[model samples]
Target: MADREALINQLAASMGAGGYAQTKYEESRYDPDTGTLYCNGQIITRNTIDLAEGFYKNMQAKCDLKTPEGRQMAAIYQVGIEGISRLRRAEK
Candidate 1:
């Protein structure tokens, strides 16, 4: 697998001359007085994309959510992205 620790640097250096880079840290709260846990760092960008039409609008790509070629993109956004992935194992 690609080195995750180098994601931020690799992405940052691959941008154009005026491209901007921002590091995002996702946190989940359990309760007001209880506690919480931090997921990890993710890359957030103010970029736009054209889905169907030829028009472009400002949108958050959430690149970390998309997976390609066995890349661990989701892990990057695990901070705020949470879902019950079989919290309990199935019975035999």
Candidate 2:
């Protein structure tokens, strides 16, 4: 198994660069009252972590790594999705 604490820290760092942590914690706030994480101005009540992982998998499936540009973009997307996973694990 992966070291979840480390992954969470890493994700927090990545998201913090763009003020995502501020937005999630201060502005959006996870509502224990509703058991939801407020994100992008929406109430994300369920499977936020799964959704993040699934999004990366879906993108990987769609991307064609036959070209240099495609490979580069896919790599970037992979990193982005990994950040999401870190965040989700941290939240849990």
Candidate 3:
């Protein structure tokens, strides 16, 4: 229970900074027993994380890292992937 709350707080802080509404995080719930997460009453599935990682990899493969724009985009994707990974870890 502590772990779940801590992860929710951390996620709220990080995502709040990224311009997401506070209400969204406030409504987030995690079921440690089932390892499931729900945000705004919607289930967050493993497939979502997998798709984000796939998008990041695809972007990295197609984008030129030498360009500032490419690097910025990569950073955005990386942050998202890291956030999702954190959520997964919290479930465990």
Candidate 4:
């Protein structure tokens, strides 16, 4: 509920302030207040949950999920997805 949304907002703010991105040498940002994601200073998405899920999925796709590193990330991604899903369901 509220806790989940707060956690997601914190994550988004951290990502934006740190300029995090999936790929190398690319800059990306997320503004939780506006639910906006920006990359290279351009608006890419307005849904922070989907943006985070997509980022993790893209990472999972690029790496081998069978490996320890990939598996670790996949597990984290699943938790994130679950959090997002819960929020969505609560909204409905």
Candidate 5:
């Protein structure tokens, strides 16, 4: 993996990276420590996993209701998850 990354970096450098060290574009993922998800230079999801049942229950019990923004995000993620799960079931 290290060699692969080094070779990619070298190749990219040879071709003028244009600020990309590895891939031509970059993507980010959810960071547990920050409780957020960043992708393509913008934050697409925040407090993402808290929408799950257990975590949501815990937050509700603690009276940690979210603001309007969080609620909207939660609804979106819930719908997306349901859709994906349904598709997986159909595939099986």
Candidate 6:
């Protein structure tokens, strides 16, 4: 589907822009139907998702959420968790 192709292209482009090798991105695969993304022949797994979530929670608990700096740190971790969640939607 067009939407799937578009999502794949967008992901590859983002990864390329982030300094990842274009060849590696090209070799990667995205299955929109299953919402699974594979890079370097390794499938993103639920364990990775859980790790991200746990890391975010740990960071949140360690930070004083009331402080601006702490809130910023939490926001950063939240973004990482969100990105992982989006990439691993099939695991949900």
Tell me the deviation in Å of residue 11 in model 6: 26
- For candidate 3, write residues 1-92 as lDDT tens digits: 97986677678557532222343557676554544566774555556657877887777677668999988887877787787678678876
Give TM-scores for every candidate, taking all chains together and pairing residue i with residue i: 0.17, 0.48, 0.57, 0.43, 0.29, 0.50
Ranking by TM-score: 3, 6, 2, 4, 5, 1
RMSD of each: 16.8, 14.1, 11.3, 13.8, 11.0, 10.8
Give every collision pair in model 6.
none
* Whole-model alpha-carbon lDDT for candidate 2: 0.62
Cα lDDT of all candidates, in order? Answer: 0.28, 0.62, 0.65, 0.60, 0.49, 0.65
The sequence of per-residue lDDT tens digits that candidate 6 reaches over residues 1-92 is 97986677678557533322343557865554444456784555455656767888788778878999988998888788787667666445
Residue ranges of candidate 6 with Cα displaced over 4 Å: 1-36, 40-43, 90-92
Alpha carbon lDDT of residue 24, candidate 5? 28
Candidate 5 lDDT over residue span 1-92, tens digit each: 98998787777557643234523256654443444444464443333433454454544444423777667666655566664345334433
Q: List model 2 lDDT by residue over 1-92, tens digit each.
A: 35885576468557533333345446655544334565774445547656767888788768879988889879988896886655556555
Any runs in candidate 2 off by more than 4 Å, and if so which? 1-25, 30-35
Worst window of 10 by summed lDDT in candidate 6: 16-25
Give the Cα RMSD of candidate 5. Answer: 11.0
Error of 5 at 13 (Å): 35
TM-score of candidate 5 against the unseen true structure? 0.29
Quote the lDDT for 15 in model 6.
59
Residue range 34-72, candidate 1, lDDT tens digits: 111122333222121112111211112334334572235
TM-score of 3: 0.57
